[model samples]
Target: MFSGLFLLAGLALLLINYVVVNETVPDGTGIVSEVVSGEAGAPPPEMYDQVVPAPRDSGQFTTKVARTAVETFRTSTMRQLLIASGIALVGAAAIAALLGWLTARRALRPVHTITATARRLGAESLDRRINLDGPQDELKELADTFDGMLDRLAAAFEGQRRFVANASHELRTPLAVQRTLIEVAMADPTASPELLRLGQHLLHTNERSERLIEGLLVLARSDQGLVSQGPVRLDEVVASVLRSTGGMAAEQGVTVVSRLEPRLVFGDQVLLERLVTNLVHNALHHNEPGGSVVVEVGDQPALTVTNTGAVVPADVVPGLFEPFRRLDRSRRAGRDGAGLGLSIVRSVTRAHRGVVSAEPNLGGGLRITVHLPGLHRALSPASAPAETLGV
Candidate 1:
């Protein structure tokens, strides 16, 4: 368009610069003589015009030509043409750009929606649908396919969760019966010391099995994401956990040092309590006599648990969060657990849309931090007065 306009503009301005005209003049019918005074020593007489005879035809004439220039570019016609051409060129370009932008935005709208829905998907939070409505084009097909995949995933996860929950419930009855029979047998009047000891060992094994089943149920639930959420006092939860586990800490010969500063987080209260309990219990269980566990609630992460024990290697920290995984040292020390403590902590943190990380402490053991988003911004737990307590 620009090229054509420029060509037209050039042609419109390139007008005739000159014009020629012809005029008829009467011929010299009669020869008129004019004599110039002669200069000294000049051959002027030979160069002078001599009087001649008259022409016979009076119609004979000489044609005289005159040249004139006609200007057309100085008129408003050229100016209006140039202005119209420029406006057309600019208008065409602007319209093209606007249309291209609108087309791209419209085409990618479904893609954006699909991306957002995928990001929000989880084991239990998979109920979203793209449901894009438009012509049966490629983008619409992609969105429909993604929605179907999510539906299938949600159904599979729901079935798996139901199985675990039901199986755990059913297994509880047999464990109860076994415990009752063992107690009744141990109550026999003529039971020998060896039988009593054997019965006690069986009872302890049964208790551990029950703990394992309970942990599995909790782990499964956490993996499904939070079903309920609210603002709960983090410091209070830690305090209660430390107090409740005080007897375990005593039995293990581990000291609990807590610096609790009230902080609020949004999540299920029961899960939050379990999170703290598991952390504290794991710390105590891994520790030796005279060892200490420090628990803190702070600004950056809502909860922090640091314990003193055998030096945990930096490279080995990541495996601690896997279910049924424990350090070689912890396993050799005869620690009694199903190794689901840190695993459950990780699941709970993920369900709450939070991050949990474990780092090897400088001296020994692990520093586990939970960075949970809160319902409302609270004061820095660092600045708040800490209620240091030993349990």
Candidate 2:
């Protein structure tokens, strides 16, 4: 709007200047010239001859007088108009710029509020929100987005605290049970074979409990810093996992097959190996007798573990990898796993900046895939061979 106004003013000024500068100036030629000499320095020639000119054959003496007056009027009017327009233009431009700046600042006020609110919020103060009451616009949308982010962060922090508490309780329960059993055995020397057997059972329970505790610890470490950035031989890691689980696979009539393509990746070797092992174990445990567990390492550096003959429950598959979320309560019912295998796989893969996905196989089974970054040459685990520490 302002630009249009300025352009119109400029055009008007140009038209006025054109009219003033281009008006023709007259050369005197009139009938009054016959009454006076054509010489200069004569005592003021007749007023008629001075103002008018010698008469021309074309009869243009009166036209000359009109033209002279028009020239004089245009020159006087244009000089005054130019001065006025210059002042007006500078004043209009300054006002326009100031108006634009003010409008921009007003439009951005909500953004400033959002920034201030976010800066004021911390881990302990995420409950606070930028409550803006205005018509729906981009600023309102931005505020809504900020509020959603805060909501998610609050829920996540709450979940973390709950997880820590639950894990601690789970770990302490078996230890407490084992401790009571051991105390009772120590108090009585004159005990039966059944009593000794009971003690043995408690010892086994304690061992299993210890494994769960260690697994939890490993998971926490994986979430923290155990997965380092370095080169690792993925083929070697898979080979190691296969060798370690070979005996377990044989016992369950689960034929272990590997179609590995040698590849290197930038990640912690132990974690990657654990991820594959857990997937393989998940497939084996959930399979029928004589079921095939196929571990395929693709040329694209993806690992796929597929098992035969086990239908996964629809609802259970969604939260299948969540920590402490079990698909089955009793081990005797089906696969008697601690239900931590998939969770651990997810954690380890995430630590190595990789992705893990589960899908139903075409031939009546489950297929799990792990895709991670890879390169040409193999890289080894830094510092130490990652081993499970029994805590």
Candidate 3:
């Protein structure tokens, strides 16, 4: 289409030049005056008026020379105009192309802002808004609308988090009081055996409820992102957890192994420890009678835990990280897990700006890996130890 328009422009310029050359240049220089011509408005010749006479060949020769000169001058002027037209046509096209590119870039600048805001958005980052500033046009309107949506989302999430944290804290006090009362009642001098058994049952239930509440509070906090960070020795955290849980591993006949590497990560130490503890507990709890749990701590991936258990389908593994999820409904996630082990692990890992994944082990088990931003710090050989339990 543009080519046709350019063709028409070129044709128009040529036609205009041709018409101008012919019509405006005076074709024969008005008969090439050889004798003096009478001035216009001078009286018309009377019936007896006398006129000057000239040689006929002389007049013809002057007229021919004038006609040739006019033709030559017309050719030279037309050639110069055509050359100028060609140069103007090419330069105009180049300028138009450059202007078109600049206009397109300016028009799409708002889209880049939208893309960057989208990339940064997350469950914890709902406060971020595009808030693009420009004219009251489509892109500006779109940005305002996006910012409004983020405002609503931030309010909603804040309310939800407050409710969960408050509800969890409020519930803990009652549970603690109930446990104290149950213990005090069972301490009576003549309490029946049945009463003692009932008290024990009630206490167990109360403890489970407390654990669930605690998990909820922690999950809510983690969803809000980290509050503070410091260099934490992740390997030492793992070693300490292994030592404390060694007796449980022996009791369950589940061998525990750990190859801890020296690594330092900047995060909340308490949350990181909770993250490792949950993984270790789940690994030990969800295994077969003779199953084994292997823990590895290192850089890059940060930590990995593999355990033998029932053959978990690949599809079912993802749900295991969700709250109140387990492989089998009848099965429990360790004695105190309350089905929130992996869920808490996931939240804590995310709070530290990391990623987690689970894969069904080929040999009837599950392997979970957590990747956190960290560095490996070299230490003496004896400072890092490989530990094995229940062998």
Model 2, position 261: C-alpha lDDT score: 66
Output the better candidate (1/2) by TM-score.
1
Query: Candidate 3: which pairs clash?
Result: none
lDDT of 3 at 97: 61
Compose the digit string of candidate 1's lDDT tens values, residues 366-391: 88999998866655546444443444
Q: Candidate 1: worst 10 consecutive residues by lDDT?
A: 62-71
Candidates in order, TM-scores: namely 0.73, 0.52, 0.71
Which pairs clash in model 2? 28-53, 29-53, 29-54, 30-53, 30-54, 30-55, 231-379, 232-379
Q: How far is candidate 2 from the true structure (C-alpha RMSD, Å)?
A: 11.7
Q: Tens-digit lDDT track for model 3 on 1-391?
A: 3445655676687678767765675443452342224332332132012221325456555445555555566677778877787777677766666676688678989989998998898766787889888899999998898899889888988888779768876888899899999999999989999999999999888888888888888888787777667899899899889988988898889999898878888888989998998998888877878889999988768899999987889999889889988678865433746788889999999888899999999988889999999854556455466778875
lDDT of each: 0.74, 0.69, 0.79
In terms of lDDT, the poorest run of 10 residues in model 2 is 382-391
Name the better of 2 and 3 by TM-score. 3
How does candidate 3 score on lDDT? 0.79
Residue 112 of model 3: what lDDT?
A: 90
> How many Å off is the CA of 280 in candidate 1?
0.5
Evaluated against the true structure, the overall lDDT of model 2 is 0.69
lDDT at 345, model 3: 93
